[model samples]
Each structure stands twice: as C-alpha cells, then as structure tokens.
Target: MEVAKILHMVGGVGETSYALNSTLQKKAMHIAKPIVQQSISQLYCKLQPTESLTIADLGCSCGPTTFITISEIMDEIYEVCHRLSCQVPELTFFLNDLPGNDFNSIFKYLPTYDKMVKKEKGSKYAPYYVVGVPGSFYGRLLPEESIHFVHSSYSLHWLSQVPRGLEDDSGAPVNRGNIYIDDTSPPAVIKSYVAQFKQDFSTFLSLRSKEIVSGGQMVITSLGRSDVDPLGGEVNCLYGLLAKALNSLVSEGVVDKEKVDAFDLPLYAPAIEEVKELVQNEGSFEFYQAKVFELNWDPFDDQMDDFVADSFVSGENAMKTIRAVMEPMLANHFGGAVMDALFSRYAMNVAEHLKKEKTKYVNFTVALTKRG
Candidate 1:
C-alpha cells in the first residue's frame, strides 16, 4: 500500500509528527562524536586524499537540527585537518531521506551554510557542496564505496513496512489489557518484528557498507530498549500508553469501540544488544562504541503539556485527532484490532498525566566502522 493510504487507514499523524526535526535537537552530538572524529583522524593519519572525502546525513529532515548536525560534523573534520596541517578536502555532503520529505526546506537553508563555512576559515577558506537526495534508505542510494562518513538519527527503528500479521488474529495477544506490546511483545510478535528488522537492517548494512570507504565510520541513533525480551515491560508500557489513548477515542464514539479494540501497533524499538547483534551478523563492521541515554522532556514540559491538552480535552476531540494521527501509521504498520483500546487508553492517560507529571524516555545510540 502507498504511504498515504497506510497513514489514512491508521488515522493520521499524531503528536509524534509534531515538528519532529526540532525536537531531535535535544539529543547531543556527543554520541556520534567519536565517529566524526575518527573519520577525520583516518583522513590525516592515513594521509588519505582530501579530494575523495564525502559525508552523508541519512534521514536528514528539514530544520535547524539538520544544519546543526552538519555543522558539528564539519567542525570535527576540520579539527583533524588542522592538526595535520592539511587543507580541508573538497566536501560533498549528501542530505537524504524519503522522497516525500521536505527537500525545499532543506535547500532553502543551504545558502546559509555556504555563508557559515566562510566564517570558519577567517582569511582562509575551504570548498564544500551539499545536495539533497530523495529515496528510501532501505536500498542502495549511493554509488558503491563512494562515501567516507555517514550518520542517521531516529530512523532505523522504523520498519520499512508494518509486518503482515500485525493486524491479524494475534492483535489482542499483542495488547495486554491496558497497554500495547511492541514487535517484541510476545515470542511470536518478537519473531515477526525481529524478522522484519533483520531484513531491513541487513539490507541497510549491505548497501551502506558498499558505499562507505573501508575505513569510513557511521553513527546511527534509534529509539532503543534496554532488553532483548519480546515481552519486556518497557515495551508494554509504551504500547499501553498508545492503547490507552485509542480507547479514549472509542469511548467518544469517534471510532467504533470494537474497531478501536481490534487494532495493534506495528513498530518496535530494539535493545542495544539486539542492535549489536545486527552489526555483528552483517559481519562487515567492527563495533567502536555503544551508549544509551534517557531522552528527557523536562525542558519541553510546557510544549508536551500543550500537545496533550490540545489532543484530548474531550472524547470527541481526542478521537478526531487520534483518528487523523493514527491512520497513516496504521496503514504503514498494517491495521489490526488489538491497538484500538491501547491507543484510546493512551489518549486518556496523556490528558490525565499532563494534569500532573511530564513524559520522558530512555534511548540509545550506536557507532560502528567497517574493518579497515
């Protein structure tokens, strides 16, 4: 099914889609700092030709965050070049993501980058060019062995498509009363999502490995869990929240209670161990670093509170908003009945929770390098 159709069926993009790029800025450059530093270090230590250097930001959404990431990466590269008394390479950076992504917004910000680069060298200067590439990162998006450094944030955890059985008879099994379970919900569910992630990630690694220079490095950050168990509690908690939200809609008559009760969520957030397994199984890369940190929302407490308020002040309003937000996600993940109650409950809970505390989570970032 088309991405649009999937989204429409599930409901619509909800608070999750709210200014996504802007929110990501809260995550630091430190997690991926080593890879950026290493790539530059390799260029200098190996006396690699600067003319061949290239960097890419996969899933580069349009916003100040993208620019910030690019700036930090370039600075890291420049530091290495400076230490070696070498002129910076002719840099060609690729900004890539889904075809529907906002290319215009990204390009609009490009000219400013040119101006900013000049400020770096003062009287000195370096040549850097950036272009936007539109495509799914699941397949080969670049020429073989053409890139030197790559980075992706909050993208890999997304399955290319929702697994087939997600909306099938097993839907309720994936939902534990008040909450929803993730791809790792049950042994069976875990198998389903793991199989999908394995396939998607394998393709991702194979394609990226071919494009990345032998010594090139990459850092990818995703919504990750702390355990490998398909039935882990954290997984259940998140699903439960979403399910609870959906239940609120059902009660309001915006969605048929029966329909809301039947749906199931198709996405999964893997544990650090699972991610490490993916890297090792691909067998082309060496692990350099792995770090997990809690994604905090204390700073955005106000914004989150407002989002909760606007979304679920009443049954009808909440259902309307949820239907719109969930349609696309449902279609993408494959629709099912298990998630209805789970999502409804999530909406109601958010409304209630905002009356008190804030929302927060723990996430992970992993960095790797192909064997030189």
Candidate 2:
C-alpha cells in the first residue's frame, strides 16, 4: 500500500472525525506553545522584516485547532509588535501536509475564519494570507530561504514507510501477529525501526535547512519515549493492546490471522537523545531547548493518580482519539468490514487495562535556531 497516499486522519467533521476527537493532540500543542512563541518572538525581533513574515506549519492536518494555531501565531506577532511600538508586518502562512490530507475540510471554514479575524483585529490587524501545500516533508516542498518560522506539533514520529528487515531470508515476517514492537520482538525488529527513523529525520532536517533563512527559528513536537529501551516505551503498550484486539478477532474467525501478522505501523517514538544527536549531525540548527513530557491517554483527565476513576468513559474517549488518527490506514489494509468490531474490543481492553494501571503518552519537543 502507498502509505503517503493513505496516511491521513479520518476526514470531515463527523462524530468520528479528527476535528472533534483531537483533544490529546490539542493538549500537546498547548504544552509546546511557550516554546513556539519564544522562538518566533526572538526571530521576529532579529529579522524585523519590513514587508512580511512567512511561516510554515508542516503536517498541518485539518481540524478545529488547525486554524486556531494560525490565529494564535498572528496574535503573538501582533502582541510583540504592540509592545515594541513598531509597524506590524503582513504575514503569509503555508499549511503543508500529504496529498490525501483533508485540505478541503480545512478550506471549508476559511470564509468564517477570515470574518472573525477582521472583526477582532479591526484597526491594528495586518493582512494575512493562507496557502495549502500538499506533499511529503521527507522531501523538499518549498524554495530556498523562503520561510522564516516553522512549527510542527504532534508530527515527525511518523516514518516515511514501514521499516524493512522485519522479514527474514525466507520472506517471512519475524515479528508476526503484531502491528508494532513488543517484548517478544527480536533485535532485528528494533534495529530496523531505529535505523529507519534516523534516515527519515536526517532527510527532514536537510530539506528544511535549505528552505529556512539564516537566523530563522523552528519548534517541533512529536511522540517520544523516555525509556532507554526502544521497545519499552508508551507507544509499545498502546499498539500492543491494539495487537491483542486484532488477535482476538482472528480467534473469533472474523479476521484472517495472516493479515494481522503481515501488518506493522509506520511510526516510531524515539528517545530524546536520538533527536538531539540528529539535530547536531544534520548540521543545520542549534537546539535552544529540548524537553520530554507525558500526557494521560484520556486528554480531559488531569488527575495525578496512577489509576483512573472512570475507566469505561476514559476507555471510550481513548478509542475515539486513536480511531481518528488511525482509521484510514487500518481500514485500507484490513478492509472496512472489521473496523467497528476491532475498536469495540479495543475500547473494552483499554478500560480493563486502565482499571489495572493508567498509562500515559511520552512526548519530546525542541526549539531550534538555524545556523548561518
């Protein structure tokens, strides 16, 4: 299957759409906002472009927060200029994602978005334009030195493709009956995933290096693991349960076991040091700040307890979150017939697990400044 062509969140604003179910992603963005603001503020003061400031949001999937992000960025720029007592610059924003992303869903709300902005910014507002760019970030999509600030949130953990070498000399998959890494996975499986991440991330930095001007700033946030073991992170537990759900369907004769064995997620949540090392090796940017943090699987839950109070509701919420981000790819591979049954079992499994012990998603965020 062509992963790029199929790799988009469940589109439209239906009950199951990413627009409604992206609270966890929104939470992560909030956590990273300070870093984003700091980087942009420093860059603006330094360049102080007379005419305009250009910004890009890579992997800018469509949702409520999609436009909210642009609004916030412009608001930040306006606030800083107000304090500095200087002329506010016009702005251009590029929203970039793969071709299959719900760009139309994003475009639908543009008129209302502009009207709201005009009412809010009446006199002090500077004009801004939005353009959608469709392509892979693993390769070049923009011209040289055209971008001044770049912000990517809850992206970059996705590898360009599934890791190779999960199969053996006989062309049999070594990590069978699993969609992702687990405790029983061989050394080959772990090595294949790590190596793929290194290659893809380096390519990403090298491409962005050409597009961003000297002295530009970037803030990137993605799923990450704090554990030294690549296979022992929060993501493993999340996908491992998903594997269990699929295997149950196989046992019930609803899904083919071979299909389960053949599928693997094209994602990796790396250790924080891995990211820092690549930024240094890529030779394009300096890390102003690098940090790791965690959030509950239930986005609305803020309790400090290791055990959740309402496991059933949290389980349901968690399933919606995962379904929004993963349904398209799963349905494409496994056939849409099994989606509803699969996630029903998944929601129950999650509720039982939550009752036992609460699990959180680990994340890493970095603020960067480009070198001359």
Q: State which candidate has the highest TM-score.
A: 2
Cα lDDT tens digits, model 2, 89-161, are: 9999999999999999888899989999999988987889999999999989899999999988887999999
Q: What are the models' TM-scores?
A: 0.77, 0.98
- lDDT by residue (tens digit), candidate 1, 128-223: 778888777887889988888888876676667655444447544343323235443455555776788788888888889999988777888777
Query: lDDT score of model 1?
Result: 0.62
Question: lDDT scores for all predictions?
Answer: 0.62, 0.90
Query: Where is model 1 more than 4 Å wrong at Cα?
Result: 1-21, 28-31, 38-40, 167-187, 233-236, 257-266, 298-348, 351-360
RMSD of each: 6.1, 0.9
